[model samples]
Target: MKTFEATARSKSKVDTYISNFMKLHPFAAFLTVFVGGPLFTLLAVAAAVYLIALPLGFIMGWF
Candidate 1:
């Protein structure tokens, strides 16, 4: 019962903190999803392409 109370208190604190952060930095969140999402996707695609190309280059004697 004490542990459950402590856990609830901890969760409430975290929820309050996140709510404050979102209220203060709504645009930061928007930009993170809007710009950061595509940038991360582009980086992931580039990494995959590089990985695929490396073995192909080696197999084709281009390395």
Candidate 2:
């Protein structure tokens, strides 16, 4: 119960912070969510795949 309350309190704080940020920087938030998110996700996924596969490829003699 204590943990649940703590989690909820922190979550609401974060939600409030984001709400205020979005209100202040609506265009920045829009660009970040719409344009930057997909690009950042793609980059992160590519990096993860590269990091995981590079060693595997060498061990499997596929490289």
Candidate 3:
């Protein structure tokens, strides 16, 4: 018999994971989406174009 390993990008898995996160830390989740999301995006897109952080974000998103 084999057990199923969990994955990160599966739709159902992501949904449940997000719901669990929100349930556990509503404020943190909210701040992540509203604050961290934009800050990271801006840092990666504009501010850090010459830095490793921008490319690292793209690589992580691809994988």
Candidate 4:
């Protein structure tokens, strides 16, 4: 029981530490998504371009 209580307290401390860290460094999370968002958008645009061009390319090549 004592060990369990100790472990729970440590867990809560870790949670509090992380919460404070994030609060102090909110841009850490924002930067992750900000950088990821552009890469994801680029991939989506590439996929869309490939999809759109595939048919056009096929028609142009046939002619």
TM-score of each: 0.60, 0.84, 0.54, 0.48
Residue pair clashes in candidate 2: none
Q: Per-residue lDDT of 1-63 in model 3, one digit per residue for the tens?
A: 123344434667889989999999999999999999999998877765657666787888952
lDDT per model vs. reference? 0.93, 0.98, 0.80, 0.87
State the displacement of the C-alpha of residue 17, model 4, in Å, after optimal TM-score superposition.
Answer: 17
How far does residue 45 in candidate 2 sit from its true spot (Å)?
1.0
Off by over 4 Å in 1: 1-21
The alpha-carbon root-mean-square deviation between model 4 and the true structure, to one decimal in Å, is 9.0
Tens-place lDDT digits, model 1, residues 13-50: 99999788878999997887799999999999999999
* Residue 32, model 4, lDDT: 57
In the predicted model 3, the residue pairs found to clash are none
Output the better candidate (2/3) by TM-score. 2
C-alpha lDDT of candidate 2 relative to the true structure: 0.98
lDDT digits (tens) for residues 1-63 of candidate 2: 999999999999999999999999999999989999999999999999999999999999998
Q: How many residue pairs clash in all the candidates, one count each?
A: 0, 0, 0, 0
Where model 2 places Cα greater than 4 Å from the true spot, the runs are: none
Q: Sort all candidates by lDDT, best to worst.
A: 2, 1, 4, 3
